[model samples]
Target: MHWLTLHTSVPMGQQTYETSIQQAVRDLAEPGWDFRASSVGSGRSAATLRIPQRVLDDRRGARLVGAATGLRHDLVHRFDLRVPPARGPHVLTMHDLPPMRFPDEGRLPAWCTEPLPSDVEVICPSDFAASEVTELVGARRVTVIPYGVRPSFRQPAPSSPEDQRALGVSRPFFVHAAGVTRRKNLEGLAEAWAIAAPELPDHELVLLGPPHGRREELFGHLPRVVLAGKVDLDAVGKVMAAAEAVVVPSTYEGFGLPTLEGMAVGTPVVAVDRGATPEVARGNALMTEPDGPSIAEALLAVGRHEIDRDDLVRRGLARAATFAWDTAARAHLDVYRKVTG
Candidate 1:
């Protein structure tokens, strides 16, 4: 079997979901189905970071797309929505419904039209998003497969004093690691942290993220916040290791990857109970309200320095173990098998 993973949607200058996506495919794709992918455009400026997205933007039409499904595994999945998989039996995966343009217009875009392909089966990242798919686009064919995390064993608790010092805490700090996006609700986090900071001056707030648009406005006024922007995974793991809890205040998420990452590092999470978060948190997290006051109260718990570190880590590790690229990959491979021989 040959896999046709249409990757025409890779961003010109960014890594995007390449790491996990590749890992998932490697772990899941059906045996004998050598995976093959092609981009509609050269995306020539990609290396230079000047990658133009014009070609991708113009592919919203219901064009009769054609492509080879590389082998016994001639099944392809159109991951990039730019070009619909109209050529073969495809397992179309949509990251989100950000591009649907139709009678409802998503009630937003005007020029675009929904390309309802005849030979494609759509797979959504989450049920929350899947509901939108079926509701708006009249998409009858859809499946919900949540993304999986890399499971790992829990590291020994703070046995090394040096490790404790490096994380900048004898006690424990709260961590908020992710890109600074509007949807991330970092502004609310900042306010919540601020309100809680006074009550619990002992616990530090270490923010780990790259500055996205409006970041300056987001954290410009924030104080006592350690901005470890753009840290590597090792650094993130170390930071997660050092924290008392991880915070996620996203207004929405297709899949909360960071929450799972935090859990893998043996850090318990406190997240807004919204979108795929509750599902991702899976009862291991200390749920928090999205509002500033409510979030402040949760932070107060961190600031008061009263959490059972071992217990939280133990539960987090247990929860994290449930999600693994291997398991996730296997699940995806099953999907491929169902589609092809």
Candidate 2:
């Protein structure tokens, strides 16, 4: 079966959605399955113009393109640019309904909350995300396929001072790898650090993604908070490996990729029990309430080595082993076959 996957041309810095798509494309490219990929925008700044070009391409012939990422109205109003009679089967991957849930974020248009096209099949990264998509889009056919951790995440490395210095981070630090958005709860994490600071005297909180939306107001005054800015995926894996513990205090997440990444490196994860955080952590990492004091206590416990760190690491390694790109690709291939057959 020949397949084409549509993707965003813009570099999705530190976002695992792009990583998942790229990994899936690589794994699914095998004999009998002729897989190809195209971006919505070419390398130019006027990439949005490519949407119409895609429509023109569709007019040429029937081609099956996997809408491998979420749709934005500014990019394309419909799932496929092709009109009826010319349109072929196209699959969409809906990571989550965050825009619908948090409209104030302005990440998505109001019309995005409307029901999806009946002809489009959906792939969700987690059951939590699938439920959200089904409720928001009224999608009838939804498949749950979780993302995989890269091999770099599994390679063990010491939390050496040299590595920390290379990343401009100090030793005895807890890492939060998500972007500094409201949904990521950086403010709450800062508050938690303040609450836990009396106990965690030696540890600093290292944030490893780009800042957004009044991040200064949220984290500027936090004494121990270090904004490391954006880093590549390899650097992210190294940072995760070299941390005292990985904290994910997100109010919502589609799949919580960092939780697995932290666990894969044998680092304990302290994530709030919200959205898919608990599901992704899977009783391997430390779970906390979505508040300052509660999360503070959890962080303190990890910092003091109050929990059985060795056992936690062992469980995390085992849990992380279960999520692999090959596994996700097989599931996606199954969905592709079902849709195209």
Candidate 3:
């Protein structure tokens, strides 16, 4: 069977979508399948379709092969729903409906909101995202496929003290690796931290990603809160490994990867119960209401050892173990078989 993979044109970075796609595509190998891949956007070149045997043979690490050319294929799998579907069998992984939900922040053109072609099938990372695709995007066929944690996160080496010092952050810190977006609820988290910081004098709140001008102004003066800036996944895993807990205050998410990452890294997670977080966390997290008081209370509880941290870590690791890239890739292949048949 021959197929084409369509990816969104995103700059190489630590964005969840980009990273998840890379992970998913790498494991999408099947014995009988012929793959050709290209990107939809113009920003960066298309994603690597096939890896060279030499690259895979490299003991040090794997390098991405060049983008494949040509569109002639039996099926086409798209990673973005924003682009129009091609003729014939097609599958799209709609990560989230940010444009439909938060119109002001992520408004899309009207064409993108139109119902997908009958030949198209949509895949979501969570049931919540599936519902959004059905209700808002008017997709007729949708599937939910949760993402997997990288092995690096599952059995991670601890980030040394020097690494922590380099980031200008210390232990007993609560890490929030999500970016500073409106849906991420950084302001709500800041407000909660302001209320809880005084009590947990030794604990610091580490905000990942690049600092936002407006959002930073609100919480920059807060005590013991470190804006660690954007770091790679390795650094993130290290910080998470050394953290007291991973704080996910986001009110909206397609799927809460940070919560799972924290769990995989054997750290407890303190997250607000909103969007797809509850679905992803599945009672493994210290879930709180989407408000300042509740978030602050959860933070305090984790920092002070008021909750059963060991239990949370145990349950989280167990749950995270079930989500594997191989399984997800097989599921994708199943969908492909169904659609092509």
Candidate 4:
């Protein structure tokens, strides 16, 4: 079967989407599928473009997809319903409904909010996200496909103290790997770290990924918080391995990837009981409320090793084993076959 992968022209720093696309491409290619890919915005060639350049790239992408024909299915990893459906079945992967949940973040364009074309099937990473899309867009065809943790995350390697030192992270730290977005609850994390730092001496809170607007100002005052900025994937694995626990305090998530990654690496995770986090965590993580005090208590408990860390690690590894990229790829192929049939 032939497949056309439609990706958004996200900048290089948007690692999550990029990684998802890469994983999809790699696994799909392995099955000997006739696959082709095109980006909907400023592709790699024009990645550094400003707004006007991006508009031109979007137009170019639209022209390419619109003119293309004979593809068995077009899988859109980025949601842009404005792009008309292809000649064949169109599959859209909806990551989240952040705009609807957090209107203050920004209003979604009419195209995003409006019902998609009848031929377009939606793929949600979790049932939580699938329900939201169904309710908001009244979508009739939606499938749940959870993401797989990278093999590197599951590698059984000893903690890299040298790598941790290079990143300026000490041992026994809690890592927060998501971007500093409003949805990530960075403010709550900072507050929780401040409250918990006193109780757990020598324990630091490591913040990974790029800083969002005003994030530096908000988290700067917290001495125990270490803003490691953006690091390579190898660095991420190393840091995760050495961490006492990985904290995911997001109020919302389509699928909590970092939580899974931590679990894969045998690190305990403390995540909030919101959205798909509880579903993805699956009794593997220490569930907490989305408030500062609750997160603080959880962090303290984890740092003090009050909980059975060994048991948590064992359960987390087993849970992580259930998610595989090949499995997700097969599921996608099944969806494609079902849609085309």
lDDT of each: 0.62, 0.70, 0.75, 0.73
**Who wins the lDDT comparison?**
3
Angstrom error at residue 103, model 3? 3.7
Worst 10 residues of 1 by lDDT: 102-111
lDDT of 2 by residue, 215-282 (tens): 66776777777777777777687778878899989988878788888999989899989898788888
Q: Which stretches of candidate 4 lie over 4 Å from their true place?
A: 10-32, 42-84, 103-107, 156-159, 211-213
Q: On residues 221-340, what C-alpha lDDT tens digit does candidate 4 reach at each position? A: 877777888887756766787788988999988887888888999899999999899999899899999889999999988888799999999999999999887778778777877876
TM-score of structure candidate 3: 0.88
Better of 3 and 4 by TM-score: 3
lDDT of 3: 0.75
Ranking by lDDT: 3, 4, 2, 1
lDDT tens digits, residue span 1-341, model 1:
76656555342111234446556777554456676655454356333212244533444432333332233346766665544344556676665553342232122223224645444577766787677666655566777776655322234243255754654445457888766545677878988977887777666777766655456576667665665566555456666766777888876666677777777787778888887778777777777878888888877765565677568768877887776656556656777777665
After superposing candidate 3 on the true structure, give the runs of residues whose Cα lies further than 4 Å from its correct spot.
10-29, 43-70
Residue-level error in angstroms, candidate 1, position 194: 1.7
Candidate 1 or 4, higher TM-score?
A: 4
TM-score of 1: 0.79
Candidate 4 is scored at a TM of 0.86
Instruction: Pull out the clashing pairs in model 4.
Output: none
**Clash count of each predicted structure:** 6, 0, 0, 0
